[model samples]
Target: MSKYDPLSGHLRRQREDELELTFAEIERILGAMLPKGAARQQWWANTTDPHTSHVQRKSWRGAGYDAFLIAGKERVRFKRVR
Candidate 1:
């Protein structure tokens, strides 16, 4: 199981269309610290290409959500995909 599986499960249980979480909060959910790359917007890109898919990307996408970085906020907004 990927370390991000917990994040996927968390997102799957959410009913909100849009959920915003601080980086610290996400780290709490994952029970680990985020990589430095998380500070880069590209790290949150919804890359669907399997060859390039990372565990973090797979987590949110699998849960029918897309993640967007909240600039200057140290947070991310997860929007449920219709």
Candidate 2:
């Protein structure tokens, strides 16, 4: 299983339509630090194309959510999309 599976599981367990979390909070859920790339807004794209190398996309997208970066802030907003 991918390390990000924990994040997917966490999202799956949420009852809110939308959830906002600081990068630190996500790291806590993953039990590891996010890669440096995570600081880039484009890195948080909601792209779900199977061929994409952005594996983290599967965590939220597979959990029926889409990820949106909170510009200038180290936070991400996850909105249920499915």
Candidate 3:
């Protein structure tokens, strides 16, 4: 049997609901990951509901982008296209 085993399948099934990435950090990382002049966007806010004011009860969406709730840390990873 091959020694290399892919973890993506396992990780995907056991995925957590939250992640964290700093704006600058993600930007830099994505920048390096993506080519120059690629369009990159980010959105963030307190993971609380405006109406209920309950923590972990709300989330906001950004146009042309997807959002992830990263608990405990303030960072995320993303992809961009040129």
- What TM-score goes with each of the models? 0.94, 0.94, 0.23
lDDT of 3 by residue, 1-82 (tens): 1111111222233234433346455445334342222232223333333465422112121111224435435444322111
Candidate 2 lDDT tens digits, 11-62:
9999999999999999999999999989898888978688887779988889
Tens-place lDDT digits, model 1, residues 1-82? 9999989999999989999999999999999999999999999999778877588999999999999998889999999988
Model 3 residue 63 lDDT? Answer: 14
Q: Report, for every candidate in turn, its global Cα lDDT versus the true structure.
A: 0.93, 0.92, 0.31
What would you estimate as the lDDT of candidate 1?
A: 0.93
For residue 44, give model 1's deviation from the true position in Å.
0.3
Please tell me which predicted candidate would have the highest lDDT against the true structure. 1
lDDT of 1 at 35: 96
Clashes of each: 0, 0, 8
User: Which parts of model 1 are misplaced by more than 4 Å?
Assistant: none
Provide the clash count, candidate 2.
0
Give the lDDT of residue 73 in candidate 3: 50
* Model 3 ranges with Cα > 4 A deviation: 1-14, 32-82
**What would the TM-score be for candidate 1 when compared with the true structure?**
0.94
Q: Clash pairs of candidate 3?
A: 18-69, 18-70, 19-70, 20-75, 21-74, 21-75, 21-76, 22-75
